[model samples]
Target: IIATVGNGMVIYIFTCTKNLRTPSNLLVVNLAFSDFCLMFFMCPPMVWNCLHETWMFGPFACELYAMIGSLFGVTSIWTMVFIALDRYNVIVKGLSAKPMTTKLALFQIFCIYLHGLFWTLAPMLGWSRYVPEANMTACGTDYFTQTWHSRTYIMVYAFFAYFVPLLVIFYAYYFIVKAVASHEKSMRDQAKKMNVSSLRSGDQNSTSAEFKLAKVALMTISLWFMAWTPYLVINFSGIFQLLTID
Candidate 1:
């Protein structure tokens, strides 16, 4: 419910407020929209299934449910990757960085969705399969199968969806923090030379904005990882026979 309403409000405000429709903010809206889709479509049915003590939607519906969840899940991962990269560009490159434009933002968003669609559809295309989870109340990529085909998909998907993005986000934010710290030192040095308590205004707004966006990205990514990492670990353990899939 919180995810649904919070993300929905973000989407609504961004759509209605013209001033908030900047190119960089478009990425934020994309993130919100993806979360909105996942929470709106996936949660209600999942709760229903949980209450009913099984996935009453049948096999086909199970697959469809898992697909929708995976699709948006992948997209959200990449969206955060893009957000981190964008922050790196703005904060590290400063004025030399190319300004974000609506065209580029939309292009990137479309590509993110395409990448997500490809991965989610791979199971349907024989790379792997989606089946009811061990709990019987949810569906997900088949982790119980001992076959190499299914195990291989889980490995490759985890590499792309988890590790790759994790690395990218880490790299971007590391540089962003370094850049901000360097800028602060420079500002303090100049202020000392002029004998002012601090330098305020001008670059302050830009730095504040960068910090705000970075905070949002960090919080969202942190929570998302916390939510999903256990499931991912379970999949890996199952593939390796560390845990009985049944």
Candidate 2:
């Protein structure tokens, strides 16, 4: 409920505040939308099932819940990837260069949703199957099964939906950090050459913003990896162990 309301407020504020609308902020808006979808559509049913101690909505709703949840999950990750990339461009390329345009940002947002939907629909179209999870109260891709189909689906889905986006996010932040360091060094050198005590206020402000953004990216990716790494490892372990036994 808090997530839904907070993200909805973000969207509302962005819409109403013309100055808040920018190519970079478009990614933030998309992220808010993804969070809203996950919280609003996925959480209530999950909370109900948890309280009831069973799948109250039956098989079809279970599958539907899993689908929507997975879709939003992927969307959130890719949205973060895009945000990292946007920050990298702004920081590394310098904001005055206009690293992204409104049209390009819109296209990127569209692609993020389309990419998520494509993978989310694969199971429904027979790539694998969405079944009740081990807990039997929720549904998701058959991650525990060791069959060829399940393994293949898991591998492909993980690569595109998780691994690829994770790599992009890391890469973006890596470059961002490097760029920020280099800029700071250059500023220090200029200050030394001028025999000044410190950089100009504008330069200091820019550096502060860069560091803050870097810190945010670090925290976001770290938390994300922490949350999802166990699931990824367990699934892959199941896959590898099954293959070894076979």
Candidate 3:
């Protein structure tokens, strides 16, 4: 409920307030929208099944629920990648960077959804299959099967959905940190050479902004890795027969 409400508030605030409409904030809005979809369409059904100890909604609902969950999950990850790239451009390129326009943001969002839908629907199209999870109360991609098709699908999905995005996020943040650190060191050197009590007011403000952005980038990457790495490891382990999924 809190996630739903909080994300909803973010969407409402960004949409209703004209002044809050900016290219970067568009990414936030997309993230909130994805979370909202997950919380609204995915959470309640899973919770109901958990409490009831069965999938009361039947097979069609099971497949639909799993697809929606998967779609939103992928969308959220890709949106974070977009956000990281935007921050990288702004911070690393500075004045030379081309600003992200609203049209470009919208196009990026569309591509995110398209990417998500392609993967989510692949199971239905026979790339693999969605089946009830081990608990029998929920459904997802058939991760436990050792068939060649299942293994191929799992590996490909993991590469695009998890590995590639993680690489992009890490790469973008690395340069962002390097650029910020260089700027800070240059500022400190100038201040020391001039024997000034402190940096100029403008320089101080710029440094502070960079520091705050760097902190945000760090937190975002840390949270994403922590939340997703275990799942990826488990999937890979199952694929390689290192761990039994049953």
Candidate 4:
């Protein structure tokens, strides 16, 4: 589910090195934590299931694994979506995007993880319950795959977990790209206008550099798209099944 060893290293360095922190990179570190949380919570059972297709741990452990994995899984998406919004505000709205302030990014991080925990833990409280069931070959399924009442659980989980975050991600990036493109176009036009006036070589070089940097940022949006796309596709297929007749 996760990749990018190079960027991950950079995020790691930024997180541990206090001087390297910024709002944007701090968010990236938050993303790494979410991915690691998913790993710690998911990878052991997944490996066990693949090798033996049985739960070495009891039912309680299985439930705990599912709950923690799902929590961080959803939180990862929320982190990216919120980062997109922060980027938009910084670039387009001129708001300060630093991590430290009276108005801080930490509060937003708290909200994101808390929201994930609230939704994921709710099922254990009689809002929903895990049921014994099997995948095609007999591996037990997640709660959402277990029973009839699970439909409500799936709907609410997918809505809060995937759909809204996706909407926010697409919306924020759309504006961010637009704003960047607009600025680049304006710079090119201004450079053209200046070209007729016999400006110095240094100013023209600055315009070219600005245009190149804009292109890089535009290209990087594809990173976010790739990160979330596979998960979204799998999730949406599950959603589509409800409307299809067996």
Question: What TM-score, computed on C-alpha atoms, does each candidate reach?
Answer: 0.95, 0.88, 0.91, 0.74
Report the lDDT tens digits of candidate 4 across residue range 97-165. Answer: 443442466777888889988877777876655433233211222433535556566667777877787
Candidate 2 displacement at residue 116 in angstroms: 0.7
Candidate 4 wrong stretches, greater than 4 Å: 1-11, 95-103, 131-148, 196-246
Model 3 per-residue lDDT tens digits across residues 1-246: 999999999999999999879888898899999989988997788788889887888888888988998899999999999998998888898899999999999999999999999999999998878887767667788777789888999899999999899899889889998988897788889989999966759646765775687678679668867987887787677668887644
Tell me the whole-model lDDT of each prediction, alpha carbons only: 0.90, 0.83, 0.86, 0.63
Model 2: per-residue lDDT, tens digit, 48-142? Answer: 88898777888788789889988998988988988888887778777565678899999999999999999889988988888876565677888
Per-residue CA lDDT of model 1 for 1-246, tens digit only, reads 998999999999999999998998999999999999999999888889999998899999999999999999999999999999888888889899999999999999999999999999999999989999988898999988899889999999999999999999988988877877787798899999999988878758867778777767778788888998998999999889888733
Which pairs of residues collide in candidate 3?
A: none
Q: Looking at candidate 1, what is the lDDT of residue 241?
A: 82
Worst 10 residues of 1 by lDDT: 206-215
Superior candidate under TM-score, 1 versus 4: 1
Instruction: Quote model 4's TM-score.
Output: 0.74
Clashes of 4: 0
TM-score of candidate 3 relative to the true fold: 0.91
User: Residue 112 error for model 3, in Å?
Assistant: 0.7
**Candidates sorted by TM-score, best first:** 1, 3, 2, 4
RMSD to native, candidate 2: 3.0
